[model samples]
Target: MPSLSQFSRCLFFILLSMIVTQCADKSVEENLADGIKFTEDRQYLRALDAFQQAVAKEPGNPKAHYSLGGIYNLMNRLPEAEQEFKIALKIDPTYVDAIYSLGFTYELMGDKEKAQPYYDKYNKLKQKWNEVLQKESETR
Candidate 1:
């Protein structure tokens, strides 16, 4: 019951929305890889962008937020790093890296006392993480 011009406009809007959504559907893995690659290359800003995209894609992915926090920490954006690390921990309580980063963030914030518990947890986890890595390396 619509006019030709009206129908064309509706179709155009629908097509545009579909195209935008498809473009936005990129996998979180792709974004994470891009982020890591950029981080390795020392392109911190680009890495941050990629990690942000990954977080956008997988809002529940603690690792994505942790990676972003790591990048920010490296860049000396302590507050931003702290925020992202906190968010990552909120999403995943047992995330060792986030806990470690938060300890560092507390240090940066001049709250050594707040950092203590996190530091203890990180040290415990780091030992285990290192052992796992060593075993994996021996296997390789």
Candidate 2:
């Protein structure tokens, strides 16, 4: 069995971890919001840093990755943008924006064949989603 002091230290470490995690979560939210604001303000580098922090904190968020990909694309960093888009698609395979943007990235790279398949997929998904939204709008 462990000593009382050892148990106390262990508990402290756990509590500290919990606090740190909470702080990380808040920072991620702040970073993500700032990223979008910076992007809209045309501060691409600042936006990239903020988005990078957000993705580091929340690796599973497809939207964060997608937005970062957009900033990279706007900066004409095609490879980085494609990587981010690929991550977004991995996180959420049905992410339409990621698929479309990946397709667009290929187009930017002058890879017409790769772009065509993704473009067709984006069109089909966009149409399907639009139909769903229209039906919902009609219902309401």
Candidate 3:
């Protein structure tokens, strides 16, 4: 019953919405789950593939970057590990695991000075978490 222009406009909006929804279905969480499973199985290459897929899906996912960094650290690829950890940290500065891993990566690379600050941050964050847990337990 609509005019030609109105029908065209409605069709365009519907198509646009579908495209946006499809693009937004990036599967970052699914890939992360697969990566964790592969990593737990000690299948490094498979884990890498999964994590890489996760990163591809969501470049801003700190967990994907952190998982990639952890894999690189295990493989003795210190520079790549450091870079991934830095990326994770850049995406989420409060990601404690990434902060700890960055310190550990620097230590592995023999950069004690670089490692020290991260270690301090890791310790501070751990302490904060512990205190939070303590307060929660006290209240309950």
Best by TM-score: 3
Error of 3 at 19 (Å): 22
TM-score of each: 0.70, 0.76, 0.77
Which should have the higher lDDT, number 2 or number 3? 2
Cα lDDT listed for each candidate: 0.91, 0.92, 0.91
Give the poorly placed runs of model 1, Cα more than 4 Å off: 1-25, 125-140
Off by over 4 Å in 2: 1-27
Candidates' RMSD to native: 4.9, 7.0, 8.0
Model 1: per-residue lDDT, tens digit, 1-140?
Answer: 88999999999999999998875876888888888999999998889988999988788999999998989988889999999999999998879989988998889889999999999998998898899999999998
- Give the top-scoring candidate (lDDT): 2
Q: Candidate 2, overall lDDT?
A: 0.92
Candidate 2 vs candidate 3, TM-score winner = 3
lDDT per residue (tens digit) for residues 1-140 in model 3: 78999999999999999997874675888777887888899988988988888888779889999998998888788999999999999999999999999999999999999999999999999999999999999999
Runs in model 3 lying further than 4 Å from the true structure: 1-26
List the pairs of residues colliding in candidate 2.
none
The digit string of per-residue lDDT tens for model 2 on 15-112 reads 99999887576676788889889989999999998899888888998988998899999999999999999999999988998999999999999998
